[model samples]
Target: MEMDEDPDTLPAQRQGNIIITKYEQGHRAGAAVDMGHEQINIGKYANHLGIMQETELPPIRALEVKQRRKESKRTNKWLKMFADWPKYRNTKKLSQRVYKGIPLAVRGQAWSRLLNIDKIKSQNPGKYKAMKEKGKRSSRIIHRIQLDVSSTLQNHMMFIQRFGVRQQELCDILVAYSAYNPVSIPGQRYSWAMYPYSAWVSPEGVSTS
Candidate 1:
């Protein structure tokens, strides 16, 4: 299913110190939504579990409203910056903004742009799919990866269920990476290495190439 044309306009709600954005689902149930050019089935989980919550410091009621307004203004500025990133990519202003902090709402997009994900994907077309297929055929380290995938981030709601969507994605990534780099045997630490990328870009956005 296609994703919302603009996730930026999605409704956001505050729970405790966490801000959760609600993404609309597609026509079909359990269909994956495109996020930053990657098919990730986060909409369902996000709606039910608030999976994409961004944490913030606890503030007083008035301060919380003030903070939200401040953040909203910053978010708008960042969005404008994203439209013409090349203009500010290496500027001191960009560095200053980064130093201040990237808004949680646009962090995923910001990370993808900063890391030049599109360029990497273009240079190595179909590599992820190829490695994933290779991973399915290869069996040397599958058992080890399976054992560690569940334990990597089990505390998080996204990975809490045994062999759930997120866990399977993690397993697929490790398997694909193992295939892509034959000499590297993925261990528990390898899962950790992939976690940060997956956290921001989703598993599909991770570049094994």
Candidate 2:
């Protein structure tokens, strides 16, 4: 037990005149291998669930989320201002707000208002239904729509399943558009498809219609 004596050089055990040998277990290395194996198993389990084993957010993404939350106040202000949008009639200000980018939560409503989607629908009553009815008669068009629908957003929840409601709706919409315009028939070699964009007018006074 002298301070200068090396512990490794000392005898492990002494019983009367007999010397007992000591064996050290390699527990550290064994534990490390076990941990690695457990990690692999955990990863396999996560894959079975179709998700990641860990849900930790990266530093950059966490910062982005924080920034997004901080910027939500601007979205709220715009929402309140848009309530009486017609009364103010400020397209210039609205354009500025759009250029800054709208929040994901309010993007749909904001774009709808900007594009006057309701007004457009009102102008062409039952147009969508009429087009859809015409599309139902074209088997070729339906087949093409089904083929494309199957591949659309395969990873997204809305379109992941084949023949899902969203996929069906998508097929209906695309087919309806194809039938709505004779030039863009599904069997046509090369033709322009006239859709809602056809109603849009550019600043240069050019109309797509």
How many pairs collide in each candidate, listed in order?
A: 0, 0
User: Worst ten-residue run, lDDT, model 1?
Assistant: 16-25
Worst 10 residues of 2 by lDDT: 16-25
For model 1, residues 92-200, the per-residue Cα lDDT tens digits are 9988998999887777677778888889889889989788766555434455565566466443556645555566666667667666766543342234355445543
TM-score of each: 0.58, 0.56
Q: Write the per-residue lDDT of candidate 2 for residues 28-131, one digit (tens) a residue.
A: 33343234333443333333223333443234567767877767888786778678879545568777777888765566566667777678878888888777
lDDT at 48, model 2: 21
Q: So what's the TM-score on candidate 2?
A: 0.56
Top candidate by TM-score: 1
Stretches of candidate 2 exceeding 4 Å from the true structure: 1-61, 185-209
Compared with the true structure, all predictions reach lDDT values of 0.56, 0.48
Given candidate 1, what's the lDDT at residue 82?
88
